[model samples]
Target: MQIIEQQIKTKLSSSAKFYGYIPDVSQEIDPAAERPSVLICPGGGYVMTSDREAEPVALNFVAAGFNAFVLRYSIAPARYPVALLEVASAMKLIRKNSAAWHVDPKRVIIAGFSAGGHLAANFATSWDRDLVTEYGYHADEIQPNGLFLGYSVITSGKYAHVDSFKNLLGDRYGEPELMSKVSLEKQVTKSTPPAFIWHTVSDDTVPVENSLLFAEALEAHQISFELHLFPKGGHGLSLGTSATAIKSNGYGLEPTVSAWRDLFVAWVQNNI
Candidate 1:
């Protein structure tokens, strides 16, 4: 609940600006310190990053006995490959400094919502293919243990999340094969890490089809994936705090997240 520590400023790419929410690791560094780490990317349609998305989500992980790094990662203004490379670079830095940060490099996870979710999905699937060089990074050097996508935009150009694609990837990304190239659903393979996704059917911003489609891909690949589709609540339901949204299942966004957090940690313990 306190800003006990921080990585004041950092670089995502040579020219792009980015920041991260590296929580206070001093509090949990026992003699046998070991815990999963998460990198949280927030939604801003790729145009901007929601600091709230990065900050609050990290704190929640900290509460769950994990070291969380919240990315105030760059936005659409900086463009696609830039944001992508930054994520890879950040993962490298975190992995290199895992000892000092008190995190287990093997248990790193990439998580995000909406456009941020798209990036998380991209990072997961495209770790081996940073095809465009604007954002310079060696994919072989960085990888995450899993993905946590919240209403991710997995379909590229054709069925793309119009606004998010336009803002983050530019209007040009909407061009046929380009959208499919970036679509995580289209990119899925047996090698993809496990994933956890949640979205509401009522979300109009990115549409539920996004997650459902990607979920189908995960199923086809025989990958381990978990999904939760809520009945109501619209886009940007960050904490599922919607007045009209029902919590009758005893798993509203907030409570549901706590359970998922446990599931995530357990999954890491078992898988990683």
Candidate 2:
């Protein structure tokens, strides 16, 4: 395990954020191996990145024979495109260093939880435009091959995750034009990458409808995607196990919900 951390320098002066993770070197296991990499964005509703979702998720991917990185993107007071640009920069850097990292650059995927899911979804939909061009990067350089979203916040409508958007847009939160622009379900297109999405039907924070709406859009566009709506679970389950729990008693942990990780890896192997 080779650990590395770097400051992601993007077009935004204030977006001097950091990304950290352990790189997978295939030579150690099989000299000819080159594995897919996952860039993880943990949920914090655009206010803060969640610790439970960051490194734990990365390690899980690593254990599944994939290289992984955890991104600490900009949050509240940073504004839109701040965190977005940071994600792009992180992707660009990972791709640029693919050889040394034993990575399959084209198979690089982005996985996010909760509000971070919104960011990942938005990036999947918007990487080809807006900030990619502004940062002088080809869309392919930062484009995710697939998106893995966990209990994501994908709507700005009736089921909107209000605080997430408020933090993302700052003063522009309620401006119809900008609000609609970040309403990810409306932004989906045929160009959006294939996705693996999961959510709890009973999630009170972000709602299952958000994932349903996104899945419907994916279906309408003929994009390949897999969605899992668990019968029961709460928001921010992270790994849904003691490993991700911040308390003494396996807080927020649900055995059935934790199984999503395995299902997700299988989906990636089969679909993307």
* Top lDDT hit: 2
TM-score of each: 0.81, 0.95
Please provide, for model 2 over 49-167, each residue's C-alpha lDDT reduced to its tens digit, 9 standing for 90 to 100.
99899888888888888888888898888898788888888898888888888888778998899999999999999888886556677887788999999999999999999999988
Q: Which stretches of candidate 2 lie above 4 Å from their native place? A: 14-17, 23-29
Q: Residue 79 CA error for candidate 1 (Å)? A: 2.1
Q: Each prediction's Cα lDDT score?
A: 0.70, 0.87
**Position 182, candidate 2: lDDT:** 92
RMSD of 1: 4.7
- Model 1 whole-model lDDT (C-alpha atoms): 0.70
